[model samples]
Target: MTTHEPVQMLSARLALPLVRELRGLGHDPAPILKELGLHEAGLRPLEARMALASWLRLHAASIELSSDPAAPARAAARIQPDAFPIPLHLLGSQATVREGWRFSAPYLGVGIDGLRAELIPEETRSRFDFQVQGAPLGPAPLAEFFMVGLFAYGKRVIPSELLPDRVNFAHPRPAHADALCKFIPCTLRFGSRSVGFEFPTAWLDLPIRGADPQLGQLLAEQAAAWLSTHEPTPRLADRVRLWLARNLRDSDAVASRLARDMKLSERTLRRKLSEEGTSIRELVAKARQARASELLGSTSAPLDAIAFELGFSSVGAFCRAFKRWTGCSPARYRAEL
Candidate 1:
């Protein structure tokens, strides 16, 4: 079979949850990943870019491989708000659902390539629309996953009894339509021109559970930084910065490890970064400083926890570094914010 070339790219993190759900359903995701030239171990460096085609193929494969016709919807419904990648988390952190969609719509490209979200206000209802531009829409399962995922997330964040007045699907009605209804529990309109939902205008003002404006601002900054690297061809320095930013908590961010993961020798990686007017050390520091500012400005987490999350050896070390970056202690920075 001729494989389709990816015309656009998205964060690999989007596939991790879906792949986990497929495994839970007793389907082997390895074959599908292999078929699409993805790493058999799993999509790694969660922030690294993957072909949009591969993401859609994974959805299609889940439907084909699983005996359950509702596999995709089930998987999406199981996704908790905290399990969402940073972009979606950014959306949920807004003070209200309407504000969340309004703020997050532009940054959708940070996670899903070719996807655009629009919030349209009506007199009594507001419609949120999802559209794929500059690429094929892929299979029906892909559309279902997007729609269901959003609704499921909304239910978790919106304080009121959540139900869309109307849900629209671009794909034709499916044989397992009943399975979808069980999860959605609202009016479902298939064969629609768009994929999204309409809810009461009043619901738009409903407070999001655990909404934090500070955290939302921090996440928005991270999303903006990630979106900057999604150009047709990003600079090496920008790519390295993004990688370090995403992996600071889990990975060491050492030069050797970064080079190995990026498929380049240490010397070559250094040379390339130098060509781009940066070094590994400089990029690492930049990532640390940016994340430090975000954590300090956003949360009341103790300095020790923040230090650990930023991969520092100790609170003292992080404090010293924070002072170097901003001429003040982390606590002081938070105080000022």
Candidate 2:
């Protein structure tokens, strides 16, 4: 049986608390959920998963309706440990904060997709970085929520003064920055390369409150079993395609960067792609073509802007490639549409 990795998805239960919190704050979440093609009933099941796009849309809509910039953070604050999905339980069971984060980082994808957590040990501090993949960052709300929610979860399990010294956000600072600080209680840095926080390295050894080695072992086994059943081993080619599509806008979609991101040597990456019946160049071309079609069909963006967005050297270069792919010029293609 051919198995594929989990696409951009998160457990539907991840959104339920936010929905409840929204309703509590006098915003009717039902209409928003319906508009997003989500039913509250569907999100109740532990096994139910929703597209990461849908999750971002839901958060964006909630913030818009409430007219509150810190709505996501507030909702996250209200989420108790028990309210979280199974994957989070795996984190809480580990012996120490560092072990919990490191051990549970791999399984977090089972509960929340499109987010990667890396625990980096620095000289005096440990940095927990959150990288958003497979989706747009979506107006800074989810990024805010994840950072704040991490601290909140840490406090529950670590039983100490568990505040990060600094927090970083990839998005620009919002007008209601103070509102976020009220929840995060840290020196917040905006316009960062990534989203995460820095805390005293000594905290890594802080014991998790009420941790049980036996329980941790059981949860680890369960998490592993759940992962194997739900998320199949991913194909290398699919991962390469995703990386190319996400990074193409930044003009960082080169083969070397891709191989490095995949943790493979360039020659090994090439050989693996050959085994998968594809090439990085072919995938990049297809990604550009697909993005071009979407832009042409959906928006009235200028060809030069589209070219730049697709990381082409110039409009002429893009035009040549488009014609080669579609057997027609971009102008003619748009006119025909």
lDDT of 1 by residue, 1-337 (tens): 8976457777676676678778887877887788888874446453566776788778777777786778778888887543466667777888877788777777777667656665656566676666554112435776787678777777788767778877877678989999999889988888755577777788878888988889888888877777676644546775676578567876454888888878999999999999877898887777788667655643567999999988988999999998998899888888975
Q: The CA-based lDDT of model 2 is what?
A: 0.76
| Candidate 2 weakest ten by summed lDDT | 130-139
- Which residue ranges in model 2 land beyond 4 Å of their true spot? 1-7, 132-139, 229-337
Provide the clash count, candidate 1. Answer: 0
In lDDT terms, which candidate is top? 2
lDDT of 2 by residue, 20-50 (tens): 7788878888888898899888887656788
lDDT of each: 0.74, 0.76
Clashing pairs in 1: none
Per-prediction TM-score, please? Answer: 0.61, 0.65
